[model samples]
Target: MTVKPDWLRVKAPQLERIGNVKEILRDLALNTVCEEASCPNIGECFNAGTATFLIMGPACTRACPYCDIDFEKKPKPLDPTEPTRLAEAVHRLNLNHVVITSVNRDDLLDGGASQFMACIDAVNSVSPNTTIEVLIPDLCGNWNALELILQAAPEVLNHNTETVPRLYRRVRPQGNYDRTLELLQRTRQLSPSTYTKSGIMVGLGETDAEIRQVMQDLRTVDCDILTIGQYLQPSQKHLQVNEFVNPEQFADWKAFGEEIGFLQVVSSPLTRSSYHAETSQGINETLSTLKS
Candidate 1:
């Protein structure tokens, strides 16, 4: 494994106002992927008063070795109040755009899609003007669960194809590459008006050809947006960095995505699914107008 490059370093999020955002989470008892996933941009995002709300619990059902979230085969019961609390946080923050994601709940009958719907409903009730984007799991190939979540009609539906196909078994042992693509494809089939987006991380020993092929596959599914970023190893116990892709490469991918018909492309080392996610508002509007 290669040593982590200097470009991957980020300034600590030390802005005094960061505490103000943290207070909302503390008061409402909400969890965010920024903290649970050990995302490198936590300080910057929180300091800016924006975060990806991680619904359900921080524990995941599958033990994807590259992931940072805790794993448990049998996680706790879903909190009925979690939706209300999450909605309260959005209301208190006065946010116009919110990102909601959750742990893999294969243990649940609907794979946690109902909880996603509840959270979306609660947020919509209080913050009706707020546009929502959900980063969802494969639901263990439960297409019905996918339709249930899509029925809520989030502004954007996102599912990350975290790594390339070859790396699935080793990096994301439980994830299926084709299943994820099918989910994105079905999102378009079910909710054509809803903008479909998917992201993949580089530096996981994936080649440039494989990355482009993944992008092509996304376009085949009629995906509207793409986000590509560097994969940062969360801990010493996790997989080591295969290579640190540079800024220029990310820029190239961004241009390539747009050239191939993606409405927008956000590519960079710091670009996570929800990184600068507010920009999604514009993409949604454009897609809406085109459909109308």
Candidate 2:
């Protein structure tokens, strides 16, 4: 019998401005992770005056079982002007911290790394003061592709592990757990100064010990930040939630992460990868803010 975890209440201030943000995005013909990935914290993130920009294209090459992004056999060619358009969108939104991500485009030789760089550059050029974060794919464990993105110099580099290794076959059949770790390790090696972040979703049949191990593994890769949250099934067609983790459990994980040497950890039932990112000024800044 499946048990519903107690619904942790959230007061999302961002919901109020969601419609206006949607209208602006529609006007610009842009896509956001908020709409594409079915992120639970979309209402909160948008209401907080922030949105994660989805670049490259809406269609993905790989179909991760847990994700709801549409998979196309042959995605459309890269949009040459998408970077500038994304920059314009960021400028218009008046975002202080822009979070950019993309669909997995394994069809391209560079694994869409060039396009990722272009978007970062464009955003930086237009909004110099605004800190930028890129939540990237593993690029099939390509070192060169990793270098291209690091060269662009985003404030934070994030790549989600999504779930524990044991659940990889069921939750993320197309993705590699080892490859994701390698990618994170490479990012830190390539640019030690860049803040490296990763996330995992609980309630996927993973044990508490397994979750703790995952956090330890992230620390092994020199990850600077971590976000852990409950996994909610996006649709009937998607993978069913194995369990619902309570708010107390999330708190325990957060404390564990800090003990394991993670500089920052955001663990809550309602948390998503990019949730409350706009408020995380930087590792030191966030720590100071939290303390004061």
Candidate 3:
């Protein structure tokens, strides 16, 4: 196992703002991926009044080796009132941007796409100015379900590719590399106005060449924003850390991504999918001004 590096270490979450956000979440009974997956930047994100809400789950239907979320063959029914509570939390936080994600709900007929639409609508009703980003699962290759979610019109639709294709069977046994790419492609075709984003985690025994090739694959489908981060082992039962990618290598990947035409690239040992999500909107404004 590679020794945990100093660069990866993070400061403890400070209170006041973070405490207030937690209080609102607790009162509404909502979940965020920051707490559920043990994200390294939870402190920074929460203290800044931002969070990636995880709707429809703390449990998952698929058990990927690298993921920390628990799996249940038959998860309980989706809550009818959860969407309003989530929207209320977004309003209370007064965020300009928000991320909403979920577990792989394969047990559901539409892979929980209905809930995504409902959540998007709820957030819009309460906080219309708050841009929404959904870091979604592959929806088990349900294109119609993907279409359903697109109809609600989020500002950014993100679905993480997670790892290189060769590692799929081991790293993400239930996930499909081609299917994931297809989902992104379909998203672009369905809603060109909605910026399509995808992310991948490195340090899973994937070669640098493989990572670059995956970035190219995403570009072929016109994926806009890219994120590359080191994958930390979640527990003894989860996949062991193959390597701790150095910060310099992450910088190289970032440069390469920019060169290949991604609007923004967030690459670092501590980067996660939702890390600095609000920055993308600012980037869009800058690019729009430049174009004009």
Backbone clashes for every candidate come to 0, 2, 0
lDDT of 1 at 172: 88
Q: What is the lDDT of residue 202 in candidate 3?
A: 89
Number of the candidate with higher lDDT, 2 or 3: 3
Best by lDDT: 3
Q: What is the TM-score of each candidate against the true structure?
A: 0.95, 0.93, 0.95
Q: What is the lDDT of residue 14 in candidate 3?
A: 91
User: In candidate 2, which residue ranges exceed 4 Å CA deviation?
Assistant: 1-16, 281-292
For residues 1-292, could you state the per-residue lDDT of candidate 1 as single tens digits? Answer: 5676788888977767679988889888888998899998888888777889998878889998888998954688999999999999998888768999999888999999999999999998998888888999999999999999989888889999988899999998999999999999999999988888888988889998999999999999999888999988888899988888999999999889889999889999988989988754347566344424
lDDT scores in order: 0.88, 0.86, 0.88
lDDT of 3 by residue, 52-130 (tens): 9998889998888888877854577999898899999999888778899998888899999999999999998998877
State the displacement of the C-alpha of residue 46, model 3, in Å, after optimal TM-score superposition: 1.0
Better of 2 and 3 by TM-score: 3
Candidate 2 to truth, TM: 0.93
Q: Put the candidates in TM-score order, highest first.
A: 3, 1, 2
